[model samples]
Target: MVKPVIAERGGAAAGDDARNGERAASVRWALAGLSLCVLLPSLGISVANVALPTLADAFGAPFQDVQWIVLSYLLAITSLIVGAGRLGDLAGRRRLLLGGIALFTLASALCGAAPTLWLLVAARAAQGVGAAVMMALAMALVAGTVPASRVGGAMGLLGTMSAVGTALGPSLGGGLIAGFGWRAIFLAGLPLGLLAFALARRHLPADRREDRDGTTGGTADGTARGRAGFDGLGTLLLALTLAAYALAMTMGRGAFGPLTLALLLAAACGAGLFLRVEANAASPLIRPAMLRDPALGRGLAANALVSTVMMATLVVGPFHLSHALGLDTGPAGLALSAGPLAAALAGVPAGRLTDRFGARRMTVAGLAGMAAGTVLLSGLPAALGAALGVAGYLAPLVVVTIGYALFQTANNTAVMTGVRPDQRGLTSGLLNLARNLGLVTGASAMGAVFAAAAGDVATAGAEAVASGTRATFAVAAGLIAAALAVTVAGRRARPGQTADGA
Candidate 1:
């Protein structure tokens, strides 16, 4: 009787295992859906870039000020990622991600309806906040749910989504603006956002790792475990400090007078306050120890410098294509699409290469490719044939994006490997912050150059914008060449020594 009962139990257990296996297979698709939800908002910002000139003409704002429609979103999104990531660790990632989609959708409506530039800017900032929350929390959720072996592939997929979204933005915006106007471009994500929110609520398991057995909300089964609580004060300080610092940089050449000085001081005070709070708190926004690694230091610098070059390209590319070549916004936008297209396609192969070869070789090769591409871009004659110029420009753009993809993927893999798994959220936030800050700095610096040169040119305004665009590219080329040294330093300082081994 006992043997028959035992055999029956074993049979039931096998059936249960088969069912669970089927469920696991389905989970992968659901995970991909959630990742796309996190992706679409940030992607929306870049997609609208092609419509900027139209937005400016419609609103009667200067081109420089109009550009902030994009810059403001990038600044807000990047700056808040750390705080958002910390919040995800404390609260639940799924809850935060769902909330982000809701907020992002609402903000998109506001942006679409904004009657003035000020309103549009405010809406864009709100959109950034939503994007930051989605980004940080989505990654946190992925880390919690996915098995270790597949995380790299999933991360690669996420990178591909990001690249695709960015690459597709201009064409999407161009089509929308040409058909219904720029407002349609802002409003395009409404249906998609709603769909994401619904899918997330239905599919994602709650990220609570708290023990069912009576234990404190601490590490259990070797997983990071924390209660749901937010450091509102720390969040505020960080936001203020970054916002103020960005404002000062964006204003350029003391354009904003005493306000810039006040902002700088406020930013400093905010930084000091954040350090105090973080040092004393039970749970901090970012761990100080994470930033102390020598490897991290080099990685951060290289990441920032590379991003700066990217932002410079974004700022200058359209003007060169439109004003210099006398192309319409559609053709110009298409020309600018090559880099991100190459980047998206390169991610999977880059990951495999990193695994096989290690980050050091890949980093050096990437930087060398970028430098070569930049040099090629800088040498084109002012009156070069349109076909030659377009081809030449795309060559560097593709090389640089591929190089960037390789470096970025390898660097992130290295950072994640070097840090404790419990602290991955913080590590990601810090890396993102460094890169975003670089973007802001690059945009502001290049914008200043463009503005100054525009005023100096005795030719037509279009010609002036063109000149500024080419000059900015030259400057970016020089900056990228300088960053190669930082890459070398990173190679030397890395630990554990896998592509995934930082």
Candidate 2:
């Protein structure tokens, strides 16, 4: 009888081990799906840039008017991301995420079939909404999907996917446009969206049903969280504020006109009002305390500044490559690709390093590297372009992006680690919001700097473009320097707090 019992116990233990292994595998698969979901939106952001010229010719619209195709998408995402996150927190992340994927897929179809440029822009805006939902919830879900010890690695993986998608955009988009036309660019998202949907449906855990009181119960305490009612007022104010700011930055074609000033003022006032409203609200969309947190606040600010510096590469690189180096479009695009490729390659290892070493240390190191690279990029390309040409530019840019990958991974890991479970979605949305805002701002501000430096760029010679590149990157270095100062100040401000200081 004893012998029989021992054998049965061993069999039971083996069965448990097998089930554990299966669970781990399932989690890994789910993470892949989540990474792709992140990738889709990132790809959307870049792929459209390459399509702008093709789109203008196809739609018979001025390039200025066609800018709406990209601007509308960006505006929609920036305006609605926070609300989407809050909605997901209220409804169910898994359910909302699936719906988002479906909506994105549908919007892509609409974009492909739209007969008018305005219609295509509208479809792109709708696609942006879906993207907001996906991006907001994807990061939120990471906490639950992986072991706490591996969160940095997970965050790094998502960053890698995002970088890969952004890098792949121009290359893939150019190919599709060359072979099939502009519509194919949008249509191509269909298969990717479908694959993501299927994987998420199969692997993501279902959200627990809310209690009758409309509160989702937290595991730590039976206390109610994710307030029952939505903060409509807060959401509206934030949307309007972001819209005004985005329009202010993007609409003037690099000119800071009266309209831009008015919009900026409006955004500032709206922001002030938003703060007051959130503070007084029963259930705020974004808790005031969260932003006041030293680590989280500084992290968001750093993300924005770093993103602006990074965008400088994109804004200034093309001009340098084409005009300064006298490269053709194909070569310019290839050279422009070096940054994203470096980012993609560095992302996973950066995350692993963050996990092994620490997010705070990695964050500082990454920023320092970025600051140094931007300083080099300011004059290195122009100084060496006579002989080294593309190498001079790409060398510093690759360094900047690798540092970016590291900073992105470390900063995101640090911020997300300390967030309340219930607020993860909102926090994630804010993180993305900061980054997007930076991108929009950088496009306008950096472009202006370059143009001003190049003076009469329409007829500027190669040397003029090189001068612009130098000046633009000089400004970029300042931005990164500011970002670094913010990070260090935050750390000093909260000496007693952990790296994930929230």
Each model's Cα RMSD: 5.3, 3.1
Tens digits of per-residue lDDT for model 1 on 119-141? 99889989888888777666555
Give the per-residue lDDT digits (tens) of candidate 2, residues 1-502. Answer: 8999999999999999999999899899899889988999998988998899999999889998898998888888999998988887777788889999999999999999999999999999999999999998898888878887788889899999999999999889989999999999899999999999998999988876541124644422364456366899999999999999999988965897999999999999999999999987867888776777877899999999998888888888877888888889888877888888898889889988988888888898899999888888786745566688788778888889999999998898888877767677788898999999999889888999999999887799988888888899899999988999999887652544464432
Q: After superposition, how far is residue 386 of candidate 2 from its true place, in Å?
A: 2.3
Error of 2 at 168 (Å): 1.4
The 10 consecutive residues of candidate 2 with the worst lDDT sum are: 211-220
After superposition of all CA atoms, the RMSD between model 1 and the true structure is 5.3
lDDT, candidates in the order shown: 0.72, 0.87
Which regions of candidate 2 are displaced past 4 Å? 208-226, 379-383, 492-502
Model 1 accuracy (lDDT, Cα):
0.72
TM-scores of the candidates are: 0.79, 0.93
Clashing pairs in 1: 47-169, 498-501
Model 1 TM-score on a 0 to 1 scale: 0.79
